[model samples]
Target chain A: MNSRLIIANIIRWLILLLFQILILRNMSFYNMATPFVYVLFLLLLPFGIPNILLYLIAFGTGLTLDSFYDTLGVHTSACVALAFVRILFISVTVRDGSDEPEPTLGNMGFKWFLLYAVLCIFSHHITLFFLETFRLTEINYTLLRCALSSILTLFVVILIEFVFYNRKVR
Target chain B: MRNLWIFISRYNAFFFFIIFFTAGIILTVRNNIYQRSVTFNSTNQVVGDVYKNLNVLKKYINLGAVNDSLAAENAKLKTEILSIKNIDTTKETVVKDSAGIPQYTYLPARVIKNSITNRNNFITINKGKADGLSAGMPVISPIKGVVGYIQDVSEHLATIRSLLHKETYISVSIKKNNAVGSLIWGEGNFDYRKAQIKDIPNHFKLSLKDTVITSGFSSFPQGVLVGTVSNTGISAGENFKTIEINLFNDFSTLQYVYVIKDKYAQEQKELEAKLTNEQ
Candidate 1:
């Protein structure tokens, strides 16, 4: 909520959105395992950010991606769901009204961050792939996409954090 | 009232989440093309401009190869045009200008972004309204048969709802017998290669490698190769048989597609609308 934080987030948003839309948007491995690194923006949002603001930011981020992908509402819904789960997971694990540090790998340690990312990424991917497919008959295929994409996204997100944020934090 | 207000305020985040979630569902279910066109689709100026720049750079890098291919395609198209220029003069129902020239025109465009992984995949091309492209115009790959319909257009960019999309259904037929069926892509990109053709008659006796092409009954021109019949199933108790086709367009690496401009489309659409309204 400081000027520097706002500036940093705006820059982060632009970089992540560009990378996601331009690079990863078309990077699918045999129709499976598309890495959506933009979710890292939502994942790294500071812990003490207001819940309503988090939801709005998530919606905004997802909606921006929705337009580019031409999958209206699919990403929007997934981002909102991810935001909800992020809030829930943080509340359950972290203390109420704690310091507003971001839940990054460097700050929260590797193990804790991975679990948090798994839950939120799965939530978003499941909501996303299912909404995009919108059918029960292809549940298996949808589930496979969710699992594969979530794993890929998780890997990319972690790698990005290690490369980008580790040096900054140190 | 005070207690109720407190409880609601306590769960305000949940309420907001519900509002956004419902909005997303509405968009997903309705697949609101008009709404998206007016708003955030890449067709919009900002996103379109960015994509245009990125594509320019990518095209710049691939310019040498593209030039060679363009020359090859140019020679091929010129020859093809020469062959098709002399369509039988006696052919009835062909749309012609006052000077007897065919009305359908083809505009080549480069694909800036293509998605084969998503269930509702779309391809964005470098041409848009400025290039005389519009919604409902048929897009076909130069090598592959049908690509998709123009879903939205901006000044410099347009998004195509490709054959890989779940909502895109194309009317097609078996080339051998002209038996028609509907082609749809909802089987989860089994390999980003397969699509299902529904409503084929059980007695059609569809064999493997039976060529599937655009059924002229629809907006797309007739006899355009859709794919070859790869799999056929005769399920029990069902009057209609379903078959799977391997799409000719390798969406995984789709680079260029042509948007077909049919001069009679407006006239045909209006006439059909009138007929439907009357019925």
Candidate 2:
């Protein structure tokens, strides 16, 4: 990757991490819908980044967020799961021959971006909420929280993409 | 050896993922109530410092509400003191006895962090070992109701396993007849106002608004108010009654709490241990 691209990605990582810990950490709608936009760091990683590096980045990001939330390992487990399956998600969404450099609204069409974001966010939320609750008796409540939070996170991710990366069309 | 090295290099990502995922799961289980592991939790210095700083800003926003509650608590305490003074003067002519000596003392603390939504919730307080706080001490809210017990304590912070936690159980009884039972926060008990009291015999005459208090068999003092019985029922094939209680202290916005230190706890525990050994 070019030095400029690397610097931009680093900056983006810091901004997302700070935004999640300082602001979004305290923002929960009706005690149910908690948006986790920090996953965008993993979602927007350059396509074909080394799998080992991608997994490490996801684990590091999740651990940092977990420290702030006081949930020691729940976030790390969910983020690693998301990172592991990210390649499969990309293969399913991207065309067989299209060599998309990244999963962004500008690089991929809006429909593809939406599908990709929804799948990733849902997986992350389901893993996170279930692990956090860790009980079968309250399955319905956990499911409701997972679904609502996933939707809220998806909205925030899409909004960020549209506002910040709108001019960089592929 | 070359082929083995190539294989390891090719699938290193999978290996790393498995290792890290297993570590995360282990940490989760260790910190859970089952293991009761005190390490690797948010009570650590780094995370606790960040939370403490954040709470400083948030505390200002809730200053008005906190002040109101404190004032209400003060009014109730004044009445209690007056009544105690009246009883003391009336009993001055009676013979003094060792039983009259107080057995418990209170230590005040502020709740820096708390959660009611989780199945196994915990509250972090600002007092710890340095402030004469230790594990197994019963904690009470600003009011008379029980909050929880101190589960883990560091130098400057302590984690309380709140009453809302599923694993929590306290020996409790009806204030009128002294009908004894146990209080538990059962599954599907999402209402912060309610808790479950099991083991009360079905034949007892239970009525609405009946008061429940700690039985003094456990960490808390006898007659500490728990709540009032709100609903009661008898499940099929069971000989006990299921009583739902509406707690007096709200857990959602708890600010100040008092830790109860039993001066005679060690002596009682030693006697119990001796009895067990004799058996």
Candidate 3:
């Protein structure tokens, strides 16, 4: 709600979007593992942010990436779904009495963060790959892509957190 | 009214989610090669500019490989010209009418964007209406093999529905037996190296390495190389044989293509339409 927090969020948004489109867009490992580190922005958003704003931000992020990927609406739909269900993830991972402002590895323990990140990334990848292929005959291939991409994305997300935010504390 | 307002405000997030989710699905499913929505595809001005710049960088890195391919293509063309001269001396001319005019003209274009991973893959080229390119014109690779047909054209850009697209069905004939069938790219064909040919009767004697070529029944011209048979099988309870062919063109690394402009296409189309209407 503060001006400083809003400014920080805008800066984070721009940085993640640039890194995603410029760097990670063409970086695929062995033609299977594509790291989608932009989801880290959604994961780190403040828990107190309004659900409506969260969904809008998710839609905007996904649409921008979709334009770059030439995948019309697949990314947007998957991102919206992830953002909509993110509150459920936070409720399960965060203790009821805890007053964590933002969901970060430093604020939330590593174990909680891992579980949350895995769930979010898995859901996003599954929805995205399936929707992109959109055929029952290729279900196995779609599932394989989802699993591999989720792992790669999670690895990159954790690496970014450690390298950038490890020194900061709640 | 107060209670209804409270209910609406309470579930506003869910409502917004539904709205956006439906919109996304509509955008994803409704788009095709012919009618691309301008808002979120790479062909739009903003995304196209970014990709154009990126392609320039990639072009520099692949300069050596591209030069090698061009040299190979030149050698192939020289040999083809020599063989054609020999054929002209020994065999009768089969492709000429009384006027002796050629039926097709080729226009060269560079592929700016292409994809083989999606369910319905498309290729974007630098030529469009300004270069005399139009929809339904067949595109071939540098080696004179089938690539795709143009589906949409803008002022300076065009989109092609490649063979890897799930809905693409090409009329092809096996060279050895002259058995005609429809070639298609089925689901889960992620490799982009092969396609499936269906509806050939089992009675035909098919063998390994049989060549497939365009039958000239559709947009593409006759005798353009399609692929070679890699596998063959029979479907359950069906009298037709299923054939797998290794395509001649490596679609993954395609950089240049030629769009064939048929001078008589409009005339042929109108005559065919007239016949159908009379019947």
Candidate 3 TM-score over all chains jointly: 0.51
Each model's TM-score for chain A is 0.94, 0.93, 0.92
User: Residue B177 in model 2: shift from native, Å?
Assistant: 1.6
User: Could you tell me how far off, in angstroms, the CA of residue B209 lies in candidate 1 after the best superposition?
Assistant: 1.1
Task: Report the CAPRI category for model 2.
Answer: acceptable
Question: Residue A109: error of model 1 in Å?
Answer: 67
Per-residue lDDT tens digits for candidate 2, residues A43-152, read: 99987678778888888888898888888888988898888768677655566566666777887778888888888889889988888887667899999999999999
Q: What is chain B's TM-score across the candidates, in the order shown?
A: 0.74, 0.79, 0.78
Each candidate's fnat, listed in order, reads: 0.75, 0.52, 0.58
Candidate 2 at residue A99, lDDT? Answer: 66
What tens digits encode model 1's per-residue C-alpha lDDT throughout B1-279? 999999988887788889989988888767856544444543356766687677777778777866765687788889988877877757735556888867788899989988888778899998989988889999998757899999999777889999888788899999988778899987644567889998888777788998999997777888787899898776667888788988887787667889989888999999999998998
Candidate 2: residue pairs that collide: none
True contacts kept of 2: 0.52
Which residues of candidate 3, in runs, are more than 4 Å off? A1-170, B1-43, B87-94, B97-100, B235-237
Q: Which model scores highest in lDDT? A: 1
Error in Å for residue B51 of model 1: 2.8
How far is A114's C-alpha from truth in model 3 (Å)? 70
Q: Write the per-residue lDDT of candidate 1 for residues A1-170, one digit (tens) a residue.
A: 57777788889899999999999998999997888889999998887689889988998898899999988889999999999998888888999766646888888788889999999999999999988776567899999989999999999999988886562345
